[model samples]
Target chain A: MQITSSLDEIRSIVKAAKKNNLLIGFVPTMGALHEGHLSLIRQARTENDTVVVSIFINPIQFGKNEDFAQYPRMFDTDCELLSKEGVNVVFNPKASEMYPDGFCTTVVPEHLEDKLCGKSRPGHFRGVATVVLKLFNLIQPDSAYFGQKDFQQTVVISRMAADLNLDVNIKVLPTVRDKEELALSSRNAYLSETEKKDARCLYQALIKAKDMVNAGENNAGEIKLEMEKVINNCKSARIDYLSIVNPETLEAVTEVRNGNVVALAVMIGKTRLIDNIILMVLIVCLITLA
Target chain B: MQITSSLDEIRSIVKAAKKNNLLIGFVPTMGALHEGHLSLIRQARTENDTVVVSIFINPIQFGKNEDFAQYPRMFDTDCELLSKEGVNVVFNPKASEMYPDGFCTTVVPEHLEDKLCGKSRPGHFRGVATVVLKLFNLIQPDSAYFGQKDFQQTVVISRMAADLNLDVNIKVLPTVRDKEELALSSRNAYLSETEKKDARCLYQALIKAKDMVNAGENNAGEIKLEMEKVINNCKSARIDYLSIVNPETLEAVTEVRNGNVVALAVMIGKTRLIDNIILMVLIVCLITLA
Candidate 1:
């Protein structure tokens, strides 16, 4: 395994892999590396001969008052985890390395950027889209693995990749969670003992909506009201947005279809955590480049 | 030489070329090939073992009322010219082939998109940046060629390519011109015979500014004011912008320096044309990326 901070050196590794007829897989993260991240790494390792993981806490993706400054960094621990997981290469670049001075380019996914997480955290998806694009170009991976926990992010990235005609496949893995029903996240570290328990209520709210959706209670407005009730019942929970939206479009829909995810963001104390439950099983299809 | 319209076919060509360690050069154009475009292709052929020219008249780069529909497309003539120029492959995919249904993503160069031609033609640079990015990914060239007649565009694209970490080298060929000093462009065809003669004024105005800066002139504002006078003399010509901008910053400079280009855009009759002349030879040395 190779550890490179330089973009040129990393490109050489990925380029050499392709020249030797090896398929490449990429896992891009901000590098606090929980079990959830490891899950993505394992999938990428299984799919390709060479796997590259990038840890860039992109400042562009964070809002002015957001946790960008206080964001977690466990580079040595993160490297140990990736090394143990058999990652072929790890790209841990400073903000200066990834974004030089006077960098003014950005990738935006139009209307999709105006809803869900994008509405509250403006320019969040733009940051994600831009960084993901930069990583895709830098790594030139044959395929990329993204966790479904960040549902809208996966959709936005997939659309950007396809729209830009990037010659790579995007493989979306299922959402991973903790035993307490809390969605595993790097921000989960910010939770106090009590706040951590209250965090599970977010997952509980999503589950309540999922049950209603599965039991033929399809009025989206009615279901959202009930989900909000579940989250509001908790003492420490503050609802950011408890709306049931179309899984793919990320638009709020009145009627629940067979393929919508119960998505929402709730602020438990100061830390914001998000989780979603898949309503249906999707047939996994392989996309041949041809 | 391979002529491929399908993504898979082009990917295969790139894959095979990579295996053989052949350097690939890309020339992305908007179809209607002219002398200006040929100069780029010739440079690409000289620089790399394999050359791919993508002739796509990207619709996104055109304003709502612009001539996207009436854009001259001499496909057969372009193919013959490219072949004669020794272009190894021409990837001339139809718009439908390039942009299938559900294409929703766009790439934007933030600060630069709102200036010069970007002001006159809204969403123009967005379309150009997006399609050029797509071509950059698909062709995966060792180097790409562009014309410097489109100065702001070349600057914005160079920033985008570097910021995105796309491995392809970008080379800007010096602008090719006709005997009358009109910058060579396919759109020059739209001008009437008399309008063609009037177009020479566009370049003439740039030369007047170049002369002022050459003769120990320091104030950019004064240079711009005098140049606009020359442009106003032509009754048929409408001055869009006469800017003495720092080539790197793309900002108005009150004092001219050793590194600046006096760029201008004008509308003669119904035809819009643009031209620029770098005052100091040292500006070429200051440019970090070409």
Candidate 2:
């Protein structure tokens, strides 16, 4: 795998690959690649001729009170993992290169970004949308892979691409999780050993809700009530929000439709973990009807 | 020139043209094409292998009291002009195509946008930026051109393109004016023959300011006062703003800089005319010191 720390090198490498008729697939990430990131890379590897991963901890995405300073940065391990994953290129640009001096433009995704994660963290998705666009232009990929763990982010980016007419297809793969069912996140490193085990409740609660959703119980309110019950039982967990929402619109839903997604975020100790389960059962029902 | 009301068709045409190693030069306009629009097309032809012009009367840019309804529409004449100028394609997508049933996306340009035109017309440049970005993506131009008549818009768009790292180069060509020095504008349709003659004072004032700055005048305030004097003297002209400031920063400057753009907006009868002249007097002095 080739690694470059400059924007020029990243552009040139991607440009050359593009000229050779290679299908470039990009997975943009903040450094400190975890299992969730690897899952995205694996998907990119499956669909495209080349996979290009960017590991820039976009400074714009970090809120003032967020853990930007203490955010994980395991560059050596990240490079080794990408090399082993058979990734084609890794763009690890410094902050200055990603954001040159006197840079003063922002990309804001509308409506889709104003709820969920947006309400909890203001200007968070603005930074996300802006950096995602910059990286999309730099990579000039045929497709970009994103994990469904960041549900709102995936929705916002998809909307940005459509609205801006960006020539990139966003492919959302299922969320990756540990064997215990806790959603994989880079912030999982912030949890103590005890907190780590306690974090398992987040995914367990999601699984419980999914089973309820599948068992001819389509009321979103009923699903959320069951989810809250499971999450409240965890000793180290503080429920941020357990919402059964229409994933496409990211709005709260009363009835579970075919494409509706049940997603939630919970605070296990200090680390935030999110998980989602699309009603795949309803998708099967639609296919049978068709 | 073939004109289609579908964005998808335009994209395919541009893509095919690009495959043939043709460089696209785009000029986005709100139809009613006049001498001003022709100047842009003619300049674009000189620089690119093929030129693409877009004509859509963007509703978002117009305020409640603005002339959106009264805005001229000369479609047949506009298409004939493009054919005469050798424009390869005219992407004339309808309002429904560009903005589907429930379109909810807006692009905001900060700092520069909030001054001059933006202050007078709130959400104006945001509309401009959003549509321009959408057009740029649909056309996939090697370079996009804008005239200096709308000086603030050129600055805002150029800043947005740089900040977003959009892969298209922005060319800001000088304003083409009539013999009487009235800056070419489609809104010149609003002017009576008598009113059009008086509009000449807008450029005349800018010329007076540029001449003064070249004669070793460094104080911005002093230059602005002299400019207002020239415009206020005209019978049909009303002073809206005449400010001599730093070009890059747009801040009110007390000291002279090596490169600065002197910009202004003035009311000529009912037409809101904007014009500018980039002065090189400071550069001459700085070069002498070097």
Candidate 3:
């Protein structure tokens, strides 16, 4: 329930927790807490003795013309929700605390950064990786919780942790969604009632691709085409990218398999929304006992 | 000293030490122990309850045509020397162990990586920063030691530590030298006896720049020219770069001032050596007793 903006205080608090042999779990978020973020915090609360959540609206992660200025900052409501979740601390740092003047070092994930979301928003993952690393250092958590809503982010951070030999377990929970199957994101707040209804196509498109794979349609191009058609059914929806990719590598898959992912990004009335579903080919094994 | 090649073993050992409230100090090196490395280890030993040294001749840090293959790695001798220094542990991981297949993450320091030694050996600091970060995470040292002979490297790592908010303290110790004033390096093993004597010119040139700065020479260009002349006295020495730079920024300085570093790299026969000296301006403060 303690809210702190000072990095030193957080470090000292974490240090004390460590001295007492308490397992720490962390959830890093961008402040406008949604059901997706709450799911991550709830998971962290169940798993560790100490739970720390960071609310940082990272500016560097946004493109020059992106909606950084318009990003929601509902601190009071977010803190109240976290406090109800039995969270130990909420780290709400100012922009200057996270990125002071003359901050120059960057953590870069090669090749993985040049695809999908990275293509539209250049330098986005670099900014994500850098701030995440700084937060990781400051918190020194035993494990960090992330939602699968940002699938590529989970992959990138997992790769970064493995590559750097960071002593952190990156646990990813399933994506939380509304009754309409629209993935819950803070940006969901930007949509009008009509635009929000149209945004449901993103998830619908992903489901369509998943259904195609389930029906033994292995051609990735054909699956993408069908998914695009599903998204285009919404008049206001404009497709950014429709991809069938290897889940681990994030590389485009020519022949869709059991674990391939169908991800899509669409512009719904000036608000960009992304959604994805893993293509699962069920192999039910039947056993007869004599 | 317990020598470990397994990362898990080191992690457990450090974990046990942490449980007992022991402070860990670390020194990372490229095997072939010399006075420079010992000085760092000795300092680490005095400061912390446990000292861990890693001997990794990182291949990524070397240029394509550089001496990565021929780099001296006297493991037995290095172990013997470390044991004499009261070292607690020596971590000697295989390259594959450090960088497994498909390792794609890299730590890059912008602007600073393109100057001085980086100009000749591109991607050197990136490799250094990446591996050093890996070591820091694995060892989880309270303080890590480095020799000041690699001046720009210290600056790059310090910037990375600050930028990333790494928990470990980066301690830079003075570069250890031989009787002839030649900076101690494992690569010195590559030089012939005559070439070794000639290598002394590297440090000698740095001294000449120091003397020039001390004698009221504020022009960086003029100081570099004088240092180049001293280096040229050794016919085998071919200057790779001779310049004065701000210690923190690593940018070439047009006007020298106190704490500016005069750094150089030279190709003596087939072996490339580097050395630097800090230019300090004497400021006499007159204290008048009233």
Comparing 1 and 2 by TM-score, which wins? 1
Isolated chain A: TM-score per model? 0.95, 0.93, 0.97
Pairs of colliding residues, candidate 2: none
Shift of residue B38 alpha carbon in model 3, Å: 0.8
lDDT of 1 by residue, A1-290 (tens): 78988988988888788778898999999988898888889999998999999988999999999999999999999999998999989997788988888898999898789988888999999999999988988888889999899989998988887788887889888777888978789999999999999888988888888787667788888989998899999999988876667765778877777787778898988888888877652345799998
Which candidate number maximizes TM-score? 3
Place model 3 in a CAPRI quality band: high
List the RMSD of every prediction in angstroms.
5.3, 2.8, 1.8
Q: How do the residues B1-290 of candidate 1 rate in per-residue lDDT, one tens digit apiece?
A: 56777777787888788778899999998888888998998888888999999988888889889989888988888888888888888887767867877787888888888888888998999899988888887778999999999999898889999888878788988999999979998889899888898888888888888788767677888888888888888888998887887787688788888768788889988778898877783343465785
Candidate 3 lDDT, B1-290, residue by residue in tens: 89999999999999999999899999999988888888899899999999999988998898899899889868998899999999999999999988998788899999889999999989999999999999999999999999899999999999999989998899999988999998888888889999999998998888888888788878888988888889898999999999888898888999988888889999989999998888897766899999
Candidate-wise lDDT, in order: 0.86, 0.83, 0.90
- Candidate 1 DockQ, CA atoms: 0.76
Worst 10 residues of 2 chain B by lDDT: B281-290
Cα lDDT over the full model 3: 0.90
Which parts of model 2 have CA positions greater than 4 angstroms off?
Answer: A280-290, B282-290
Q: Write the per-residue lDDT of candidate 2 for residues A200-234, one digit (tens) a residue.
A: 88778878877886787888888888889898998
Chain B of candidate 3 versus the native chain B: what TM-score? 0.97
Q: Interface RMSD for candidate number 3?
A: 0.8
Per-candidate DockQ vs. reference: 0.76, 0.62, 0.86
